[model samples]
Target: MKIKLSRIDDRLIHGQVATVWAKEAGAGRIIVVSQEVSEDDIRKTLVKQAAPPGIKVNIVDPEKAVKVYNNAKYADETVFYLFTNPMEVVTMIEAGIPIQSINIGGMQFKTGRTQVTKAVSVDETEVAAFRKLAEMGVELDLRVVATDPKGDFEGKLKEAGL
Candidate 1:
């Protein structure tokens, strides 16, 4: 399956992602790669019910997502891969999933995370992962929505309206 973008947003299947990025990327399929939503078949079914029939929504576990993503399908259509959190992206990378870059749409401020932007919060470990991904030539973008796209947090956070 061809991927348009790997987006990390706390709210997996929401308005901004389903409509904004989906259209921007010209994506016909949405692969929701999350353990929480995929592990429970009930939630998976419910999310499918939430999707617009024209678009394909496959709520699969990360492992399955990677497997399907790497299966070597030569499709002309683009697929948007959505993850719930940064760790999911990190885990996918660690597990050999090829995510060139990721966009930070939204992440909840957890206990140790310092609020870096209006919608982004990063702790020590998360910062390290971000930096590591950056070092690995992955472009990490920071934008609350499609209209307000920004990125390169460690270096460009101050330049952008964080």
Candidate 2:
């Protein structure tokens, strides 16, 4: 399986992701690797429903995602991986998935999380996970849409003092 794009979007498969990002990635499949979402039948159904027409959507847990990635049955698949957090990305990488870079698309603000970019916010745990990803040599591309300029994720993390 080829990774066309790997993104961290809290909202998962929404308008921008179902349309813009998916199209930009040119992936035949969109795999949402989130343990929580995978366990929730309602969320899985909703996410699959939100996908663009003619494209397959799979909501799998981190372990299952790694299995799917290593499965020979999917060798010819081009996939766009949408993750909800940096920790899951770290999990995939640690599990032997060759994810080279990750796009920090949208991480909404919530209590205990500091806003880094307009579309991104992070708490201490998230910061640590992102730091680990960086240490692992994963290029962090911060952007909202495909047309938006890629912001400096490392610099933004520094500025936020995260």
Candidate 3:
């Protein structure tokens, strides 16, 4: 598969992702699949700037991303997919994108979200989507960076009484 790593991080293309995860995944391109970020010109530029030199960044909505993923054009490229939320990942999977594993990098705590970890948080809707992903046999690996010990994301959610 072209998707080397599928990660969910609120700070989409930040230092840790651009430097650490990208290097670990050996990805040639970083695809940020979020309609919100794709529409924001300033955010798009910022995310592009965060990418390491020589690496391409594509900020596109989920639908477009899935189409690109299914197309043969990027068959030779290694991609690290980034999403700010679980719903997007669910949408892609439901649309027939094959994602075997997902890394839960960061999800900042918002008003209605419950803290799952210092770097991860989720609300009811997110919890439901995550459960669905788990049910579909997608392994949810939780870790802040490549060096950190990976945690079983679904197990944590269950322990948190989701």
- The candidate scoring highest on TM-score is 2
How does each model score on lDDT?
A: 0.76, 0.95, 0.90
lDDT of 1 at 28: 84
Better of 2 and 3 by lDDT: 2
The residue-level lDDT of candidate 2 at 23 comes to 93
Residue clash pairs of candidate 2? none
Which parts of model 2 are misplaced by more than 4 Å?
none
Q: In candidate 3, what are the lDDT values of residues 1-162, reduced to their tens digit?
A: 478999999899888987889898888888999999999999999999888888889999999998898888778989989999989999999999999899999999989888888899999999999889989999889999998898978778877777
Displacement of residue 64 (Cα, Å) in model 1 is 1.0
**For model 1, what is the alpha-carbon lDDT of residue 97?**
70
- Between candidates 1 and 2, name the one with more favorable lDDT: 2
lDDT of 3 at 32: 94
Q: What's the residue-level lDDT of 79 in candidate 2? A: 99
Give the clash count for each candidate: 0, 0, 0
Encode model 1's per-residue lDDT on 54-124: one tens digit a residue.
88888888788777767767356578888876667777787887789798888778797677777776666
What's the lDDT of the predicted structure labeled candidate 2?
0.95
